[model samples]
Target: MADVEDVQVVVAHQERATVRVGEVFLKIDADQRRTDVEVEAMARAPIPTPQVLWRKPPVLALAGLPGSALGRLGEPPTSSPKAWSAAGAAVRTLHDAAPPPWPGRTLDEVASSLERECTWLLANDVLPADLVTRNRRIAEAALRPWTPVFMHGDLQVAHVFVDGDRVTGVVDWSEAGPGDGLYDLASLTLGHREHLGDVIAGYGAEVEVDVIRAWWSWRSLIAVRWLVEHGFDPAAPGCEVDVLRSQV
Candidate 1:
């Protein structure tokens, strides 16, 4: 039998919990629909993903990826530029593949959510009005129509696993669906703007820089509240708050 001492809580919040034991991960989610999407997305993704070990209601077990995550929030990446570029290439491959059958948010939906979040932030005095206003203007560029692609939806750096200069796998597919390709790119480079050039180079296609920038703001602004409520400190160095402040 596996030793109970090996278990470690990776993340825990009101809605879900993820624990690691030996070389496997156990995810417990409140909503089964999200797990359904995660299973489907992993099956559909063209790139490498953690192997699904087994599934039982509310508990999905997965084999661990081979390497450490590409990076973490609030810290500079130690991985080489080549690794960053490899992640970009992996993203491009996913985007080029057939999109997921499920629908994603429309531009109007994103705009509405941003409006609602901004109102909450302002009413609660969570951030300065000027900071929110400036970032909102920057986020406008992303509200334009976009061609849909298979998106990881939460392609944050920590979700990507790398071995040396190659991408080994990507995880966390709960939000995967047909969405803007640039949003994935933006998510990968959110707090690591210095790596944007290397990632864009590896993406190997013409992309609109301004639109990517717009997603940075949109993602950061919309995530602050969720991050806080989840017991994460968005105000920590190199986090969502820093990403917003960097625009100044």
Candidate 2:
């Protein structure tokens, strides 16, 4: 394996960079990059994001926050509750800062993208129809009532960085979109009940987390179905099927 440091890894998980007009430009991974660019641009955010520092087609300058891809607790505070409160506040600040409307894509466009990805998964024989149907149900429920808000579509602990209870930064900008806040919450906790409960309690919002938890449970079941049908690899870990089995 190549060292990430030696390679000057400007962008990863997509492809290599190319040069044009004596300057390096990154080729956008059409499957992913557009949403990242749009969401960051829309936010016009104060916090530094990777998308804003575009170099060229596939390259961008990194902000050099000293953390791993899975985030780091740079310093430990004396109290966990205090640390949790501060981290929650930081997340609220980021979400409350509104972004511009994502220019061209409509709800229909997003639906189409979902369909395409689901179709691709099915074609590859990597997922099951039962999972697809369940995913659709959860998605529809999430979208049914609320107006769209900016969502970190794939939020997780890995994207979060903390320095002694203070949030230093959020790392990935890809897979961002306009969607339900709870959807973002679901992704963030990834069905970890305790963690999800902590985040909800910390937020202190009026809304019930039960609805969100329901969505998360349903969504998680879909994921488990996919993994089971697809055949698990030794490198991957999941208990989604176990959770579903308990429910049944």
The best candidate in terms of TM-score: 1
Candidate 2 regions with alpha-carbon error over 4 angstroms: 1-39, 46-54, 67-85, 103-140, 214-235, 239-248
Q: Give the per-residue lDDT of model 2 (tens digit) for 1-248.
A: 34333333243332333222212223444344654564454346545443344544334434444433332212222334444455455455556666445643355654555556556656766546666555655544443455566565556555665566555666555556556666666655552444555566665665556556545645554354344444543114334443333222
Candidate 2: RMSD to truth? 7.0
Clashing pairs in 2: 25-56, 25-57, 25-58, 26-56, 26-57, 26-58, 27-57, 27-58, 42-100
In candidate 2, residue 74 scores what lDDT? 24
- Model 1, position 48, has a per-residue lDDT of 100
Error (Å) of candidate 1 at residue 51 is 0.6
lDDT of each: 0.93, 0.49
- TM-score to true structure, per model: 0.98, 0.62
